[model samples]
Target chain A: MTFLPPITAYTCVCAVGRGRDALRAALTGMVGGLTRFDDPVGVLDTFVGRVDGLDAVELPANLTDYDCRNNRLAELTLRQDGFEDRVRAVRDRYGAARIGVVLGTSTSGIASGEDAFLAWSGEGPLQSDFVFEHSQDLYSLSDFVRRRLALGGPSYTISAACASSTKTFIDGAQLIAAGLCDAVVVGGVDTLCETSLRGFNALQLLSPVPCRPNDADRQGISIGEAGGFALLERDEGGSGTALRMIGYGESSDAHHMSSPHPEGLGARLAMTEALEMSGLRGGQIDYVNMHGTGSHLNDRVEDRAIADVLGPAVKCSSTKGWMGHTLGAAGAVEAAIVLTALEAQIAPGNLNLKRPDPEARCRPLMETVPAELRHAMTNNFGFGGNNCCLVFSRDDAR
Target chain B: MRLRVAGISVIGSGMVDWGQAQRILRGAESWDADALTVPTPTILSANERRRVSKLVRLALGAAEAACDSAGLARGAMDCVFTSALGDGAVTQAVMSALRQPGRAVSPTHFHNSVHNAMAGYWSIGSQNHQASTSLAGGQGSFGAALLKAALSLSQSGRPVLLVAADHPFQPPLSGTRPTDGAFAVGAVLTPDVEGAAGPLLDIEGGVNGPASETDTKALHGLWQTCPAARAIPLLEALLNPKTVVLEAGTGYFLSATVSP
Candidate 1:
């Protein structure tokens, strides 16, 4: 039985110029940022890798009912840049019914909701802008994307905290493998909000300095916001570039609500399953994009697991240095990074690591490393002890 | 891939409140786990029992019943549990606490707020280390859960047990409630496993049809004020040989079938 061929990936990043050009620049080290901020939530920090010149414009009066800055930013990623035209071109070739859309986000428009609450405090309910539509509605993201893109087939929103968007690829692959859809547009997007900032502040996990992933003296995680999406298909002939989701593994630890299992049991299981499903072994992995949120427990557990499973030879890095942890959008953003690395042949260096933890067994990539790309994997773990690992490889390299 | 639903069961406040515990038996005239019990025996652990919200308990208890009915150990099955408002009790607690400054949200309450809290509890209780997933799709939650469970079974050889549950929200929160009682739907499905009596019907085709009058009655039979109501229409159709289609959502186009 023939399975869906692996999809090629087209990606862009902070260092890379926007679109393919920006992505190419990111591959060559064209970017660095303001890394200092005085805020406790890490939102106003100097190193936020925010996309320059992409401002949230006031949408038309008719679309005001969908009021939310998150959704408005979402439009720039989903519709601007002629992405719809590119999608239509793919549909013209693959057929419309064959395509599906699955998106991930932890707090869809929560920032907008936070704004509304502040407005309600100042202006009475009637005076407040139409903010309620965004705050409480569970379908805020899905409803907006589906309506805006006119995507009729099986559109849904996934919210599993930071790991949400990466899991969308898992769902997308299953649908295509099951012959549900021939193609899927999958990714995640999230904007910063006061709720998230305050929530992290309350947790006492925000780093005032730029985050250092594997450093022994690393502070807490630095927060970042971004929107990233990828159009995926079973066949290679589609929009952007083709990158197949070769393998994915999902497991729940049931161990802790907010903390990872001290043993990294779920993460290890996810990595093992992903490798197994990909029909590859630990020795075959050329690079791994660690979840490296810079949290003490997270980095320690992940580092030990990487050393134990894949060994000390495999190159690893936490790009969270370049971009603050994008939370829900991290998976897609990192996925973009992985594809960019494979295509450009240079792995992005882990940004702020001054001294690698001696206890960490896995080798942390400190500078742009050039290599013959074969296979790469990205891992994400969520708040509920939910873990997902995805493995992507160069179609021709293998 | 053609996957089979090998075994399934549902337990809910509706069945428990109906006072017909025997309906769950292999051969009972009627067993409704939704009924109210006479003695109201506690189903949760002593430490957390008092604070157990109806939905969490029903989800756990119902999945246990499902394990019992399927004759499979909890540790043996891959699981998927879902809810629209996971631990509505927790949401209420958090919202109320947030209203008061300096009131710390209980760590327990915060943990249970995840939509898949039931799955997390099941994983620990059942000791099922296999893949477990949690999904929430508002009114379309059941169908979404079913789709996810079937996909899991298909992709992997493991037998999957799905528990979908929900409870009526408390006052103020009640306005958001879709069902009035707590409910849970559980199914033990194995790849290519045939039912003893017949080939379990695998549903396909129009699942999102526009709602109509005929669809309303069919949907009403499945409708209850709880998340477990999802299993009612399904179990009703399965028990009755004459039953033809199980409408999964409001749209007329989507339905699943069980047939030879």
Candidate 2:
């Protein structure tokens, strides 16, 4: 009952770069560390990974009807690297009718909106810019991307919290397998905003220090922002370089909304399903991208769940240190990282970790290591117990 | 690629108020019966209900009706929940809290604010461990949800419950009124069994073109109001024999053919 097509091309825009070429370079460690922002929030002192030199530009006159920095960043990210042309050419070749776009994110443009509302009241409508409105709405980013790409196919935006983007991959596959499309573009884009920053800060979840995933003194996640995109097709042959989305699974905990189920019930369900879909046992996976947000609860729950299913033998690491928790962008961004690791044959080191959590149920990767890997899995469990797991295998061999 | 429309249910707002569901069996049989009289309460327990948002409640109501129509227990159905704005009230609340830095985000509101919160609540309420998905497609949320549900049914050899819901805009964002009310709709899909007489449907076509006259006709047959009411159009299309295609505006497309 395979219902998804093979992935065709995958690319991302992060603190690393905008297009595949830049991404490829970043994968090779050519791109150094991103800039750090001065933080008034005490927990996380400075952001480790971030796209440098992204300034607030005047919004297009016609497009200045909304509020949201999230959406603005989305447009800027997609506009970079001639990504639209690459997407358009792919769609044109595949037939626009057969190409679909799916995105994953949370708090699409709330930051801009929240800011706009404040300005409008204090400074007056003349002082308030309409562009702020577009940034605040969650759909702005997806709608903007859809319109910009001129994608006439099924366009969807998934918002399952951190797992949002990972689920995008699965949805794209389903769309292609249903014969609804020939090719589907799936990814996530989220921009750092006061909404997330202040929200996490209020929750006391923001660590003044850089996030340390699987660390004994792990404090909290550093909320970074990024956008990632991948092109998927039903056929692997005759297509350009592409990674096969071998298998994926999703589940919900119905547990506490913000908190994961103590036992990682939903996480386990998604992991098991993904493994079953690949026709591979749990132990077959060589690498795993843990959804380690460096938060107290998330890391512990995920560690227990991974250990319970894949066992301690599976090599897993959290890449949050490299780019912070990109929220919706985490899934696709991390996916790109995994693909990069596969190409480079070396796993990226988990930065900012002092000591491993003594209570961890599974072993965690502390340093960069080379592993000629075949299969890898990335786990993203969002708020409200929504969980998604994606399995990636190299096309040449598997 | 082809799947059957095994079962479907729509719990109108009228039912939620009356505390009794009204079933509208389409085609030759239009029985407006009290939604399968049940002694068990339709709403969740007080403690459980407090934990879920209004959106989840509406979805659960529809899922109950869908599961009943499909002759499956709540535990037997896998679920997929869809919404455009996804509990805007909760989102606004969280934003307000963030605006006031150093204030604690209500753990409850923070949890329900995620896109899949309602879907998670449905899975918990139904006690179903099957795969559950929450998807967003803007105005095309219903179509997207149905597509996922149909695909899940095709992939998993079990009945799937597709719940689509969206609440009215809360304050600060109530400028636009699209239907202006909270609604929940559900449909149960299963693998087409041997010697089945129901409608055999296959969703095809990608996002393309504005709504055509034919698409409008198909949509007209599907439901009355609630433009986002994808389930109605789906049920209507399945019941109507002449119409075979329902293209859901550059989002998703569904086609149905009745066979004996």
Candidate 3:
């Protein structure tokens, strides 16, 4: 069965910019957001795509219990492009009880929890106000959104590492198809945190420089934090020109916890399933957003999968060069990037590439080029061998 | 939409196995949360076993038990695992490690930190290629996962395995969670088929929260501590010879009726 849900409205806040315009400009200009990141844990010297002005991003007084850098960043994104207002509009369109909220976050409030722990070690006990409501758990992101939107419908959070937010779209579509909710507010948010930085560093995936996807000399990934939300609804009746989600496929490697399978078997399965569900063939896709993390195995395996599925002809690029890897938020932020690229009819080039990986199957775009952008696909694979692919197309193409 | 429960398992403080837990839920046996002990998943390679956390053990253990109980190959179905509170111990370890200058993070701990780590381990152990999802639905995690699994069961021709696991956060973090026993609940639900045994349940979606009507306080506390016990309402029906109604929050209810 075809799972089609049109993204009626969407917005995002990332290191590259705040909304579609900022992201699109960065994509078109090939500007990289990587800068020398001062390791919060004081472990290593590396570059990161950290979001600016997080300190200035104020939390509403009512949400003090949920006050944390991650939630603040989520709120910052929610306040973008009138995303909250759009959600309220959705709630209004379909009574509040008919709307569901789904969010993805790898590090919801762990950053705040870390601070609280540090104080505990220095002092005696945690302050009386320290509650886990919006603190360290994964549920806080969705809880925050649900309370903010005042929606009394189904709500949840997905945390499949990098694929966390991407899978939320699939979940939302299922919720809608199952007739549980008329409209689903799907969002992804992950903010910079000590655990993430130190952990990735320990895994030796953090690049010493701004990441260069598929670049022959590319080293590793530059992590970033971002938040984005999409309003997903069943297509009732329309001119068929609006951008909407056509298909999604979720799979697991079951191979390893952290590293992906060398053969890209899981990647192939996810991409194939997505294409099958979208009712489109490899030749039908105009562009592919590779989950290029600028790492050796990641790009190599993903490229092999892309080559086998979309073939060498389809245009492919990694937007991570522009905003870094946003972890749980990568899926949603990159999905938005694909939509913006589709809108402009331009396939953004893979930035910071001095030379392409010889093992790559898909030709990496190095310069922005106008094309007949129709059906675009994006891939996001996370830890635990979790993989997800989403297909979005312009309704006008119908 | 309804599901035929082929196999079910619950692990926590009280029972030695799912069978014992089922017996207790049925009121045939005494309840003891302290009796729960998570054993090493012998299904995985020793190397893989060494790298797993307690939370992984809880999830995969229950999956194995459920599949075994249903007389189905573990990989014969897709899987969905939901946890309201992901392993607090791991989070605390990572957080403490990050607070220092050297910041020496254990390679094992870092990889085991993802919410889907158990799903990945289960896939590796079962060698299943089917899709898997890990979710957190705040306080109503089990209900949300059941709804998601129902979606999968409806879309796919194969059965879907739904696992809900919750472990109290460690230490000061554990103070609030109050759930003394870490538990994982497993249920193998297939498309309701003809001649599928005597007891069957039709999960009717669209009911909000646990019914305000009535229930034993012990069961309520079980749910409070072990989100997996949210299935207690369902187990209450399966354990008893009588058909019962299970209410899911957010106005979605799962109505399970035993076959006459």
lDDT of 2 at B124: 65
Local distance difference test scores for all models: 0.64, 0.68, 0.80
Q: What are the per-residue Cα lDDT tens digits for candidate 1 across A92-173? A: 7766556666677766665553443333333223223444334333345655665565555555566666777888888777
Best by TM-score: 3
Give lDDT for model 3: 0.80
Q: lDDT tens digits, residues B1-260, model 2?
A: 55665556655443342223222323322433223221232546677675665666667777777777667677777777787656767766765665444534666676667777776667666667666777766556676676777767776767777888766555454443333545577777777778533467665554233332323342343233343454444444554544444443344455544442
Which residue segments of model 3 deviate by more than 4 Å? A122-124, A236-241, B194-198, B211-220, B241-260
Displacement of the residue A2 alpha carbon in candidate 1, Å:
7.6
Model 1 chain A weakest lDDT span, ten residues long:
A118-127
> What C-alpha lDDT, on a 0 to 100 scale, does residue B189 get in candidate 3?
83
Q: Which scores higher on DockQ, 2 or 3? A: 3
Best DockQ among the predictions, by candidate number: 3
TM-score of chain A of 3: 0.96
What is the C-alpha lDDT profile of model 3 across A1-113, one tens digit per residue? 64678887788888888888888888888787878887544567778888898888877778778888888888888888777876776677778877888889887888777
How badly does each model clash, as a count of residue pairs?
49, 25, 16
Chain A TM-scores, per candidate, are 0.90, 0.89, 0.96
Error of 2 at A284 (Å): 2.6
Please provide, for model 3 over B173-202, each residue's C-alpha lDDT reduced to its tens digit, 9 standing for 90 to 100: 765546566778888888877755434656
Using DockQ, rank the candidates from best to worst: 3, 2, 1
